[model samples]
Target: MRLPILLLTLALPLLSQGQTADDIVKRYLDKIDGSKKWKDVKSMITKGEYDYGGIVFPFTTYAKAPSQYKFVVPFNGKYYAQGYDGNSGWKIDAFKNETTPTLLNGSQARAMANEADVELEIPFINYKAKGHQIKLEGRDTLDGKQFYIITLLKSGGEKETYYFHSTTYSLYLKKSIAKNIELEKALLDT
Candidate 1:
């Protein structure tokens, strides 16, 4: 009798915790800015600093219709530019070695390049819950508030696992897997 009661006590809290994480993901999708505003935008210009492997690089991107885009990265007193402006793709290096009319064939690379228009809309899109595998991993206190862990899996093989503030439903961290690189490489080679 004692064992049965103990199991019930432990299970009740686990069930509630899973529900809390699911609620947080739902609220976050409905309220975030990126998901809503970016989906409809046709063109944009963005300037920011990209930090990779502890090195900071100044970057700028411009996008237009029909797969037109320009990306510039400045590092160590030089600038590198790459783009596809409707007709063809091109690159200009620090030494001014120009490569124009270069074909960009990899699906993953093209998808990544095209994603500039969609990234800002992530917060506002209505993500259909095909299914959910929720777990109450653990809790962390940050800036005097606590957060819950939630993982969401979409039917299309895209996964997002995020940490949401318990009180605000605001996300602190999110991980997603998009596009398959092996298939992309094979496409590029052909």
Candidate 2:
């Protein structure tokens, strides 16, 4: 009876551990627009700023269904556009010159392009789960809320670290390193 009780106590922690990991993943997915929402989207326009050191460069991205995307940077007055018309992948830069067919080597670019597609709604579908490892880095008090640190790996050698709110399960921060560059920023700006 004593041995059984000890084993059960140890198993309880393991069970809870698995549940916690699953909950974290679910919460992360829920925070983003899910697959269903993605599928119905016909177009998307994202306006954001890319920070390089202390300089902030504003960029606007527009995407139409069936693989048409245009990224415009007003500061440079140019558009870097790409599309797959069900046959080939081509790009046109600010020079109004078309680029030869090029394949994307990094997962980040592919993910971003897919997100721009109206047909493919899932944002992280290109990412494969390599493994799940949890670590308690430390408590971060931000805007009067605490967060937990977690990391997830992808099969394509990409890693994303996430900081999630301890109470709300909302993501506070996320960071990832891309392995390749599909588009040159300078070329786009020109």
Candidate 2 to native Cα RMSD, angstroms = 9.2
Give the candidate number with the greatest lDDT.
1
Task: For each candidate in the order shown, give its overall lDDT on alpha carbons.
Answer: 0.57, 0.53
Off by over 4 Å in 2: 1-19, 28-47, 51-55, 62-68, 76-145, 178-190
Q: What is the lDDT of residue 84 in candidate 2?
A: 42
Q: Write the per-residue lDDT of candidate 1 for residues 134-167, one digit (tens) a residue.
A: 5556677767778776665654445555677876
Count of backbone clashes, every candidate in sequence: 9, 0
Question: What is candidate 2's lDDT per residue for 16-62, written digit by digit as tens?
Answer: 44546446656666776545566677777766555444465666667
Candidate RMSDs in order:
8.5, 9.2
Regions of candidate 1 where Cα sits further than 4 Å from its true position: 1-19, 33-73, 79-124, 129-138, 141-145, 176-190
TM-score of every prediction relative to native: 0.48, 0.46
List of clashing residue pairs for candidate 2 = none
